[model samples]
Target: MPPAPQAYRPATALLDLGPTFWDPVEGANFPGTIVRYRNDRAAAEVGLADLDDAEWVRHFGRFAPLPDTLPQPLALRYHGHQFRSYNPDIGDGRGFTFAQLYDRAGRLMDLGTKGSGQTPYSRFGDGRLTLKGGVREILATEMLEALNVPTSRTLSLIETGEELVRGDEPSPTRSAVLVRLSHGHIRIGTFQRLAYEQDEDGMRALVGYVLRRLYGEESDDPIRLLDHVVRRTATLAARYMAAGFVHGVLNSDNINVTGESFDYGPWRFAPSWDPNFTAAYFDQTGLYAFGRQPEAIHWDVMQLAASLRLVAESEPLIETLQTFASHYQPAIADALLWRLGVVPRGAEPDRALVQTLERALRTTAAPLDRTFFDLFGGTVPASYDAAWDGLRAALADYRPRKPSDHPYWQGEPCAMLIDEVEAIWAPIADSDDWSRLHAKVDAIRQMGEALA
Candidate 1:
């Protein structure tokens, strides 16, 4: 008998890069397999929308390899700096890349897991994800995508019947395993690992692989790769700021070559334009605060440049690192304009509008998300105070891109503040009611359509 034809095309591209980049491993046998969430929209993009609930759990929960994708999962190896301290002992501690395939657009995508089980990199810690943690990631990625931020889609989240002890949250929480749809699993830490070993050949091979596979280019020049990554990271940081988001941990390992945001942990959305607001409770120093995201990302890019120096020249990499500011400033302006539903004017005028808006936000007590909602489409409300004068002037000649007639525009703007997040979780924790979570996702999707 022959195997049945699958709907999606599978590829073993990562295996082609050879065994140095990753180690093959097996997934855990969970006691329970209950599908908590399924991303049908993202599934449609990958031709998996036809999968029934049973099939979804069989593939995602049991970690079964899709048809011809991967015979076994791969635990990727990498190292990164955590809180400015170098640590070479870190890698995929709780997850592995399960499968790879081309999306409908013919773009290569990876099905990576979180809390799927232990690996060589577990480092004396249990490889488990809290159910609450998985819920937070789902909310973060959905809200970010609705805000037009480039992020890895949360494909599936399945609750595993287990009790887990942890120090961060209340101990003995429920466990879960998450599947993420991402462009690639290769991180800056991937390059750093090669550089730390003084394996110049490995670094060279990795650069070629990244360019050929993820970037769709044919260049081995490490400097060129660094430049591309710097620009993309800059734009990513700017979008984070414009969206009033604080990615609590800006570790190099958390950032990937594709510049898409993934691996959510202790992330938060800013209520107002406060620079000192931090996300992670342990980040008492505010190193990755709401305002310092650009600086943190710039420092990460510098680390990448230093890693690339193992194979490339010094001056060009240094020069490429310096371009972060040039890319970031314009990107934030454009991102803010897009959120406000206004068309772009020239660079200088758009910048002025952003600066004025920031200044106004600082002087008032209004939440940043609400401020954006009120002044959407360049309309300065008559109810606004004198603090909005500068912003009103800045937007005087600008016209809105579209009328604020989307049904969502009439009511309050959707906000993922901590209080709201907790409110949504309370029902599920108490009685397994998921109505609020479902409703929130629907509202965020509507907002995305309106913004588009």
Candidate 2:
């Protein structure tokens, strides 16, 4: 028989960072709790898969303190630039870090809640998440992960039985609380807060805490930390391009220090490789469009470097910031190769493949996911024409990582296009039918396995 699952290992790394980083808060007294979605796969990683539905809801929905974890939720503090406009009065307005524990890999993971309740940062708005919004987050994380993007995994989503009014969606829509499993919650905005206050001591303390606890690096040098963050952030931006994903909001607060992507809002997957495609309807300026994501991410990294100037010299930070493009260009080729399930020949050939394929995608306007799916292992079918000639030549010598015999590769690629997302939500909104949603998750998993 297989070995039994290990017990939950509670951690206090965040608490050890001191009270300056967060404020203790209570979760909202939700009128009713209905388990909408629970990720058993993610729970197993954190040793919570053994819990029954009631037990799960008690901890996740009711926000009960875990056996040896946090005593109460902590609302983290930070400031971010929204659409390039600096906003000093924003933090975990509608969410709070609920608990900390070690995953099976011994890495620290946070259980952060969304739509749980309000905090000091709520401002004049209600701190609640619409049910549809929660569902979208789940779908976004799931699809992104399948495409090999390092993202926060949705742990649990529970309907809170509260009707919320919003200008974005239909008024008086159902509300829910969502819990995400993430590597860490420290954001670029976290450092910006201390920098804005001109608190040198706080800046040094925060940098030390991140290095020792999250990164496992012994040095407290902020320059080293900035370099690590820039590298990871570059790789993340490349993965987003490879996945054809548009994270509508790329605010500093939304970008985590760990380089893991989280906080999904108004996100969309591309139907075709259109550089001008924007996810948010309000993004009239196309500031965070699909093609501009790398630039946006680079800007966020620069802000991070700027914050580090409190503890480090401006020269090294500038040098570190300049390395983003160098890391990003190569990372894009690697990420695309992973998605295409091909073996790399060399840097020159791989980059040529990426460049040629991009040109073909832009000119042909072929379906983004489908094009990658069809060309898996560099196999170009006879249906190709002159538009694909450049891409075919570039990929001629490459070989597939594995055989494309998976049943999923035989049919239409599993995609989360906007229309498909709405189609999945329509049933839940109209008749509470969730079969389609569950089926999509299952299909997405199959695709992930095939890619793996």
* TM-score for each predicted model, relative to the true structure: 0.97, 0.98
Model 2 Cα RMSD, Å?
Answer: 1.3
State the lDDT of candidate 1 residue by residue for 80-153, as single tens digits.
98999989999899999989988877778999999999999999978889999999999999999999898999
How well does candidate 2 score on lDDT at residue 53?
Answer: 98
lDDT of 1: 0.90
Backbone clashes under 3 angstroms, per model: 0, 0
Candidate 1: the clashing residue pairs are none
RMSD per candidate (Å) reads 3.2, 1.3
What's the lDDT for residue 370 in model 2? 83
